[model samples]
Target: MTTILVPYHQDERLLDDEIPVSADITVRSQVPDGDAWQRMAGVCSATAAAVSPVVAAGGIPVVLSGDCMVAGGTVAGVQRAGVNPAVVWFDAHGDVHTLQTSTSGYLGGLSLRLLNGAHPDRYADAIGLRPVPAERTVLVDARDLDPAEVEYLAVSATRRIPVSEVSADTVPSGPLVLHIDVDVIDSGEVPGLRFPVPNGPSTDAVLAACGRLFATDRVVAFDVACPWSRTDDEGQRNIRTQLLSRLAALAHPG
Candidate 1:
């Protein structure tokens, strides 16, 4: 397995130390002359390029990025490798908001939605990412959701479930792209989360759920999104390091 590190929160590059030190490949954004959408396209394109060949060679790629939006690139890369994969998205908040519904207009909030055929002009189409169908995309542990997100999920074909319910029987059929945002763990357990949601699952529980999915051996890509503030404290950095190591271990367990 190759670890691809993209140390950026959207277009803004994160601190150098924000990513795990085990990176085999580091993606650098090459923004073209255009608007915000075009810049994001360039970033996602860079990530996709790093992810494709690894999957084609039958190796699972573990992508570590600063935010969930990079997931579009992971999916695109898998598709480029000729595998049509379902998506299992695990996060604290529902990443299903569109530009119209989002009050803060945060692009990260629309990550999953864009993967399910939203805003093709700016996102999916820009990077040549074929959107996964709603039924094939599952959102896990979205405990903190906006009213608009809730409404969309209620009517949308996408399946929503808790972290404890993630297993082979519940997930979409065929190959999968597992996208886990570290914030899914209880905010109290993970320090410096930029968008903390209290009263979530424990770190152990989250790992256990991930273990179940990895055991299936049908996961094509493991994408980890660390949407947290940079920490100077050694204790906090240690916690983050431990968590990332555990996550990487899941994809290559002996």
Candidate 2:
């Protein structure tokens, strides 16, 4: 059975408009307070508690919440269950910043870096999840990266498939954890993001790409980070619905 785990951020209200319609879904809210790092750890612990049983019985596909910080917790859950899953990170920015290098100091922006073993002080001992090696990680549709992040991407072995080159020959296969940051969609199409970039992939293109990738039967997890938008809530909800429907279609049949 595929278990969808929804870890809602405390500061962000749950988008209860479209969910709860699915009978197969199991929704668990994980609202955390206090420092960003601590809250992230709490979220991960909660996720592990919710998914351990399903994972122990063989393992199940998971659809996690949209806070990019939640990726750490998802990683912890998967790792604790003894699954060495490949990770496909779909985003505009690399999310590869350490505390020292990050200009914004936004914990969301640093989630990926924390997962990749960048900063020991900030995340190493706290998260209890080791970074998935660069070889096992593939980043797709990444264009708006910071300078230091670009440097890390250049040196690190993580395969990068730009939005333009997604059709290229180098895309990686699963057992994969597919992470989608909604900001990767152009601001015109997904105008609900806190940071809207001008040029990003179209919804159709992203779905098609994900469909092709998920057909590999290696995608055991899907995590989406679509931040709440004050302006276009309906539009963002529509996008999320479409994306989730596509993911459900691509998921392996029981």
Best by TM-score: 1
* Cα-lDDT of candidate 1: 0.93
- The per-model lDDT (C-alpha) reads 0.93, 0.66
List the lowest-lDDT window of 10 residues for candidate 2.
17-26
Candidate 1 on 18-92: residue-level lDDT in tens? 865579999988885687788788889999999999999999999999999999999999999999999999999
For model 2, state the Cα shift of residue 157 in Å.
Answer: 1.7
- How many clashes (backbone atoms < 3 Å, residues ≥3 apart in a chain or on different chains) does model 1 have? 0
Residue 10 in model 2: lDDT:
28
Instruction: Assess every candidate by TM-score.
Output: 0.98, 0.82
Give me the displacement of residue 143 in model 1, in angstroms. 0.5
Worst 10 residues of 1 by lDDT: 12-21
